[model samples]
Target: MSKYVIGDIHGGFKALLQVLKKVAIENEDQLIFLGDYVDGWSESPQVIDFLIDLNKKYNCIFLRGNHDALLCDYLKNGNYTEEWFIHGGKSTLDAYKTLDSVTITQHIQFLENLKDYHLDNFNRLFIHAGFTNIKGIEFEYFKPLFYWDRTLWELALAFDNNLKVSDNNYPNRLKLYNEIYIGHTPVTRINKTIPVNKACIWNLDTGAAFSGPLTIMNIDTKEFWQSDPLPQLYPNENGRN
Candidate 1:
């Protein structure tokens, strides 16, 4: 029973399917999606439907990314900020011709169940984004844990709740798990920079939304697999999106 941790699939269903095919994934295999399941690409609605179907057929663990959070807010509150729409929510709305009230409610419920962190094989942890600098209950909090920035990751590894009057940014000094895998930050290019790791934390966002490869890392063998480079919509020509 091999478990594959996938990178962000932000409405790039075609690229995701191609990557799964390339991996020759089996029914028994378990897959954990890091997050950003919708938005960015032109097929947000279809991507969500496909993922729902996949859940019925295979073992899949879905986590909540920042984009997913925005969609949830829009559906529940009837309005979301311009930032979400600008960051690929428009294409997501374009996917559905007309979703009934029941459908809308169900989709939001599904998204709500997604966790901010998942411990694979009870050893490997998966999160949409990074964790906060605080420990104890705050470290496990979903919002900050799923949307942390570089500064947070650095701080998370630096301080332990109560700061001693004298403390420095000691990344290597902090760790409580074997490995933590995450997505949300595009990796500049296909297989670019390898896996971003800070001791136990591992960043696996392979930039699929930016037309980069969809990555699948095998936990048992400590090996990696990738799909062909997908098309990018960004005009800057920069690798990371």
Candidate 2:
């Protein structure tokens, strides 16, 4: 069975569908979605619905992203923040506007139940973002960093760029896994339109929340597929910008 890891979809339901169609996943194949399933586009509810349906047919692992956490927090406690609403949350809110209370509650449960990270038998780690302050694969506080930290990606990029002179000496957090797959930091931020590999960390978020395409990668072969750019798919939307 093939193992696949998909990047942040950010409510781009159509793009997600296109990428899935391109991959042509089978029943035996497993899919690991790297979170940020809601926000950005106009179909956040539909995205969650699709994922729920997908879980019925295949083995699916969904990680919680910062956006997802914010949404869940709002759903649970009605804690609304301006920052959350501005940064793609508005789109997500708009998407959920038509759903009934029961459906919204169910979606909240789905988001709340998402895992923060997943580790496989192959020594590959899948996380929505990255984790710092961990001891031997166990986190020592700083749990929110798993879905909110940018420093880990910065470190990986620094090492990749040869900016750090000591290549062999990595921080303890980076050493925990043989290969780490992350999605919070979009590769497009580095002017890359494709998945980026640096210091054994693979960044799968190709910025579907912005202008880039949604990406899906084969864990074993390192082969990948991408959807059309977000701007191309949804012509009028600014998409979390």
Candidate 3:
């Protein structure tokens, strides 16, 4: 069976479908989404429902993203605070409010149940928002990773390969666990730079909901697929991506 990894969906359900079509998913194949399945785009509900359905229908792995975490918090706390909402949490709440409380709660739990990261014995890892101590899973770091400054990663990228991420909030490269597949940091395109793996790490988030493009890459085959957003499909998330 072939293994696949998709970039951040960011609620671009339609675009996601298009990319899936290009990949021509096979029944024997397994697909893993790096996260950001909801939020940013207007189709948060559609994306969540699609993911839930896909997991039941096929072999798939979904990682929890910062946006997904905010959704869980909102469901339990109903605190639509500014910091979270400003990062696409507002749009998620708007879409969720349209559904009944029961369905919303179910979706929240589904999203929350997603692990902060996924790792296989075969030198592969799936993560969202770049974890500092990627040697293992750390759900507590999700918040900081989500709201973290990209400058940290940028600095890490610039320094020597031996650098490591410090526990005291200092930016050092802790040597990412495996060939990590992470999202949350938006890019103009499917840009990739592996500080340790000699280009094995892939940053697939092509910024679809940010008006850039949706990205999907087969981890085993190194095949790249992309689809641009439908016109105005993402006017808001377009800000940072």
Candidate 4:
């Protein structure tokens, strides 16, 4: 069975469907989604519904993204921040308007149950975002970093560029896993439209929340597939901008 890791979807349901079809995932395959499944495009509810159904048919691991957490917070506490609304949360709220209470509750339950990170038997670590202080598989008490940290990716890039070095010859976090896969920070910020690999960390979020395509990678083979650029999929929208 093959193992696949998908980047942040960010409510691009059409893009998500295209990438899944491109991959042609089998029942035996393990699909790991790095989260940000909602809050960018016009179909946040549809994306969540499809994912719930997908979990019933496939071995899927869903990680919780910062956006997903913001959704949860809004659902449970009626707390809506301007920052959250600006960052595609408005679209998500609009999507839920047509759904009934039962469906919305189910979606909330699904989001609430998502894992923060996943560790495979192959020593690969899958997380929505990178961690800071980690001891083996255990991260520090700062839970928000699980879905909002950018410094970890910066450190990886710094190390890759030889800007940072250690006497032990490897970053402490990199030593814990054979490889680490993450999403959350789009690769486009670094001026790339594809996955970026620095040190032992592979960033899979190809900026589908904005202008790039969603990416899926075969973990073992390192083969990958990407959807058409998101702007092309939904030309009328500016996607979180």
| Winner by lDDT | 4
Give the poorly placed runs of model 1, Cα more than 4 Å off.
134-142, 152-169, 189-194, 232-241
User: What do the candidate models score in CA lDDT, each in turn?
Assistant: 0.69, 0.88, 0.67, 0.89
Quote the positional error of residue 81 for candidate 1 in Å: 1.0
Top-down TM-score ranking: 4, 2, 1, 3
Ranking by lDDT: 4, 2, 1, 3
- Cα miss at 156, model 4 (Å)? 0.9
Q: Compute each candidate's TM-score over C-alphas.
A: 0.80, 0.94, 0.79, 0.95
Model 2, span 1-241: residue lDDT tens: 9999999999899999999999878999999999999889988889999999999999999999999998888777888789889999998877777889998898988998999899999889999888767473375487888899888888888764443434565566666788999999899898998999998799999999999999999999999999999989999898987
TM-score of 4: 0.95
Worst-scoring 10-residue span by lDDT in model 2? 160-169
Q: Please, what are the lDDT tens digits per residue for candidate 1 over residues 125-164? A: 6777776544522355446556544544454444455644
Cα lDDT for residue 42, candidate 1: 71
lDDT of 4 at 168: 56
Clashing pairs in 2: none
Clashes of 2: 0
Model 3 steric clash total? 6
Residue-by-residue lDDT tens digits, candidate 4, 25-102: 899899999989999999888888999999999999999999999998887778899988999999998887788989
| lDDT of model 1, residue 26 | 83
Candidate 4 positional error at 152, Å: 0.8
For residue 13, give model 4's deviation from the true position in Å.
0.4
Poorest lDDT segment (10 consecutive residues) of candidate 1: 232-241
